[model samples]
Target: MVEQIVEVEAEAVAPIVFWSTENQPERAERTKGIIEGFTAETGIPVELVLVDENNIDSIMAANFAAGTLPDVAFFPLDFAAGWYAEGILDASAASSVVEALDATTFSEGSLALVDTPDGPTAVPSDGWGQFIVYRTDLFEELGLEPPTDFESIRTAAEALEEAGFIGIMSGTDPGQVFTQQTFEHFALANGVSLTDADGNVTLNTPEMVEVLDYYSKLMAEVGPKDTATFWDQSRALYFAGDVGMTVWSPFILDEMAGLRDSVLPSCDECADDPAFIAKNSAFVPAFSGPSGSEAQYGQVSYLGITTGANTEAAQTFVEYWLSDGYLDWLGVAAEGKFPMRRGTTENSTEYIDGWGNLEVGVDRRAPLSDFYSEEVLENIIQGANNIDRWGFTEGQGQLVSAIYSELVIPQAIADIIDGFLTPEDAAVQIQEQVEEIQAALATEE
Candidate 1:
């Protein structure tokens, strides 16, 4: 008989813990599914911890104090860089992972969000680009062409409003993500940027004021009366067939799926059923303003491994998640979630078509559908990268948020929009707040 020596096997280790905000159920589910799939293939177990986004600070603090930080974490873009700066994250190893990933696969703009001093600290999972989703059928009905500039957008809005529909749908309410809707579009239109070379704030220029003035006028005219109440309320109004056109991220395509099932049936039986979004909406690149300027777009979120994580395991996870196959799955699961890598195919077109078909007032047209469109994608990538080149460190993101929130910039903008204060007055108020913030930061430095 062969040597009958009994050998003991090593026990399997537990999978790394990954934490994320439970804000969007679908996103959470998609992430969970992917992780589970990875475990199934690799026999690696993963535990997911869902937390409220607002409570992340307390949770992270507690975890830090206890030396029990998660192996991997999904932090907001605004705070991630700062964490990296404080040595709370292992950026050097993270950079190696980014280097190993297919750099050419990602859009230049999207990759910039994750690029850090030590290296690319994270991989972007989701992001919002400035795009105009308009009613195509309505434009055709009114004999109007798609607008290429800000003035044309205004004209189109006026025409749509005259046809017994709200021209534009935007939520400009204070204490909301109104900046995403207003400042992004306005700044882009006027070619105004938030930061200049050398990482200095440069929003207090004549171009910025002009852009703000344009937004103020737009809010007073075509914007919904209740826009000041909420940012997403406009989405509801748009889906209800009351609004003709709107500017929103591609995620709106996903949200519209549920709305169509729940709301379309009821609307079909109503008197305006046929006329309600008769044609599917189409997305176009945002237009330029009178100054012939175009601003860089914004990045929404990114994914990275925590400094405390097992380096090899974290890299393996990041590689799997950033792979083309996984991105395709994510596109199907989340709809408008575009892939960061260029030349990668995804299931986004199907979702886009479905949402486009449901739109009543717009002709079904596809505009700049390619994620790598040079004119649009390239510029966006450049701007995003430029942010980092200018040294707008993660610390700056926190500083920006603090200044905006504490000084109540939103309220001041609202006042300007309401004509209660002049643009110059608002600018001065904003400048004073910026100076105060600078002084405080100087002391810390």
Candidate 2:
């Protein structure tokens, strides 16, 4: 539980009140280290308030109502546009910081995702793309191709099942956001979008229907019998060599390599070497489907200067965050925190190069490069700039927020898997429900 401070005592010259959602002890320590460096260089003291990611929205709302929103907030992409719409974010301040830092240095894709007619809704800091990680050793023995697309994935899953092994482990818990993210990744590969340019619901399209059918059939055939399986189950099953493939975030890199004691690889080959699975695993950073183009579902965090911010100080801190303090920030969880600001114009790949060498892992520390090859590293870094989501660019961020908050897609998926609805019917159900949500939001306005 987050400690509730009823009031923030003000200094003669107020410290920059920064709200950060990375509440883990290690992550909070790393954040403090960066803030210390910032103060040493710029003499701008910052009070770091660690906010739980799950509680951020409600906390921010309460703060907004009380006129106590922090000077700066490190928050998730899902809230970026919605907060901006609610007049909580100071877009002009965020945009000015981006401009002052040289906008070209940032990942164009990151910037594009939050771009508004006015300017950026927030400064894109860092993010990770979802990955399809498979057992290369098993694939080699079974003569299966990498699971890069729908058909290839299906083929590999079926082959694994026929060989008396579990085919895949992916999120299935309808109540969890991981399920939404997992399904969205597959849907994006199949050219699924929440809406078109004019903000119309597009979930009932043929493409969506095809994706639903493919996903439901594939999961029903080779996935776990229980629908409660989620990220933890998927990762644990993969580490145990019980599943041929698992879709996961890059944060699993260290844990897979046995550097993290709590979740080290426990495969048969790992009896002698915990890194066995890490050595023989292959990753697909981005992939395409028969109906759609190549894409990866990405989640980015942003630094928003709130409407109640100490503007000049907030901008300065943001610039410091994306510049001098950037690598230190990324080093906290290098595997997941891919740099949204790649590097300075002078050294085009400076931060990327530095990030590759930064040490990761908890029980044992080593750079990700020590485990993953240069080619594998490049796939993750390069793919950072090619991410997609449901509706940020379509002026439908509010709708996307509504969809996630209600677990709309996950509900439809659960119904399909339970035989209560066909993929075709699920598509229409999703469309009508989302349309109603969009309409309700419009009415509230």
Candidate 3:
């Protein structure tokens, strides 16, 4: 008998490094657990590095220069496309994972957020839409419709104030990014785009002026007097049932249900039941204004594979994460981490259904469904379908990043509220300033 030589490709055994921007101790621990499960299932080791979100850009830059980038990273949506543009991301690795998982299973909004001509710059993991959580009981008592648009919101705020409740609470801290986020939700509702189809700055348009005027008036007339209220103030006041409505992220869902001890409800009704406010509240995920269609400001996080990564290993890891380990990943912060992948082709709503049942909250645990009605939960899910952002879909993520970094919109809103600048003046100033920034960016290229 003649002996025949047989050869087989060896499986990759190289350990991959995974960087995460979720540096909070507890969040980091949860991520580590997910990584461990991935390792055990595939025999592929991963090193989890917790990095401060603030330092991500600088650290990634240094790693790029040194040619020592990690295999994969869990980063904010803001950096994904920009990094891919800089050639620091391995698009092939992420694309392969998306293909393997079946692209149709993911959220359309999430995928579109990071899309490029080549493919998705990164794989979207999860996200939450900014919410207008309101007093459903109060609206019912006054015979008011849900606040689905600017006119309705304004009417509701005025009526609620007359009924002895603070009308609305929104972030006004000029120096904080929360203020930008809060204002962006209203700006988007008013059909304000940072740039036109040709990438020309259009911040001075009538629609933006109307948005500024409306927002400033609402905050001045019925909002808190301090003019510096942020997320904490708004959330606390709403939980106390002293405010008619407040702008917040879905993370407030678990807290409103009295899931987290540190931020339990304090309303008078809560004396009888901790979830009183939750039972009385309703959420408006997206709203519209006269000049605009309905929309919501969504924030999504992405999993990016680095350029120098062990591509095969990184791809496998990401696929595992979005498949067998996806629910566990979303469970860490279920309220905020809405699943990007809805489910497999065979079970379209599997992940969404699983996500709804995952326990959320710190100190104590309960599924959001326990405190919210099925209709309310479905409302939140539907909101994700309307997620929109300025400049992102227009291939201007870099400019969007610059706008946030400079806090231009927040300052403009602050000036309007402070009486230092008229809405028209703020619009002109914003247009000029953003145009200047856009010009400078153009020169760099």
Candidate 4:
């Protein structure tokens, strides 16, 4: 018989292909470090690539079409569910990884963001809260309560506008998702469930009309006259002390504090204290809407193991991600990272309790515990539990998928605010467009 020598090391070794949409260089460098650590620990190499977040959808779709999909990808929950329906996600493998990681240790609400009717379409990673980041000094100086309601917001905006500053700064670009996200963040509080309990599209309801009217007014009166800016411009405007408030992801925390010099460039005022802008800012997690319930958007993202990937090594990476490698991952941007995996069964709450202690900023290390009160953090965490948007709550991910891909609602909002149509007319037009999108998607399937 021929010599049967088993090469165990060569047989076991497999390189993981990870496509990350972390475009920022500073952040990407830190992420690379974590991957390096993983390689050292596991002896499994990772082929890492930095993808453009703006064009990730097209890139991923093209890769899939060519049968060249990567082993893993950092996918946002916003569009993952729709992809799941196309049988593009490996839910079976992802669900098993979740179970191995200890499901209870992760945030139930965050997991629900990625959960499909079949099961979790992607493995839950980390998430952040969406809320209003406003001027603390201005609010305190004017004796204005938090912008938790429409009336207070209007009052604050008017006062700030008179002081020779923009009252509000939100993304209004017609083509960008920022405007749609801003609209959802604001309307969710107004009780504008874009879809009803049975997953029916209800974008043309009276409540949505009210939401659009208010949004248009805010844009016309308080927002930047340009109405063409998105996150970077809006963030610069706020940190430079030219705007009163902005609605954005919690990722603003570190940038507001001047952690990454590459993005959210430091203002002249920040020369004295790097975290000056962060200290002067006030955060309002969510506001009580007409529905009497304060709703906050939980923008959860996942490290999904792509279908047809090397499942064993992919599973290994995920287990490491949720366990030993987790702290380092969150440490890269601790300011915004709310722990999705709270802890393991051995030490429940361990990760969460340590999360607050994670320091922020480049020159200084200030714990989040010191930055915001425990009560405030608790309230924000509570909001994470109720996180649901139009297509997110019901099994209507397709409706949301269509709404975003087609820019149906964003166009309607732009039309009304830019004087192309009235609120009622815009609503009618959007409804008609959504119907067309549904038909197109159905035909494509």
Question: Which numbered prediction scores highest in TM-score against the true structure?
Answer: 2
Alpha-carbon runs more than 4 Å astray in model 2 = 1-12
Residues 47-156 of candidate 2 have per-residue lDDT tens digits of 88888888898889898999888999999899988898899998899899999989999999888889998799899999998889999989999999899898899999
Off by over 4 Å in 4: 1-12, 262-271, 361-386
Residue lDDT tens for model 3, 1-445: 1111111122366788888777776777787788878887888888777787878888887888888888898888888867988888877778878888999998888888788877888998988889899998999999999999999999999998999999999978788788889888999988999888789888899999999999988998888655687899999999998999999999899899888899999999998899999999999999999999888998989899988899888998899888888999999789998888889989999998998899988888889989898889988987865588888887888888888899888888888888899999999999998998889888877
Clash count list over all predictions: 20, 0, 0, 0
Q: What lDDT score belongs to each candidate, Candidate 1 first?
A: 0.57, 0.88, 0.86, 0.75
Candidates sorted by TM-score, descending order?
2, 3, 4, 1
TM-score of each: 0.79, 0.97, 0.95, 0.88
* Residue 323 in candidate 1, Cα distance off native in Å: 1.9
After TM-score superposition, the amount by which residue 333's alpha carbon in candidate 3 deviates from its true location, in angstroms, is: 0.6
1 or 4: which has the higher TM-score? 4
Candidate 3 at 103: error in angstroms? 1.1
Task: Quote model 3's TM-score.
Answer: 0.95
Writing each residue's lDDT as its tens digit, candidate 4 over 99-151 gives: 99889988887777677655788887777778888888888987878898777
Q: What's the residue-level lDDT of 9 in candidate 1?
A: 23
In model 1, where do residues sit more than 4 Å from their true spots? 1-11, 22-29, 226-229, 257-278, 343-395, 403-407, 442-445
Residue 57 in candidate 2, Cα distance off native in Å: 0.7
lDDT of 2 at 214: 86
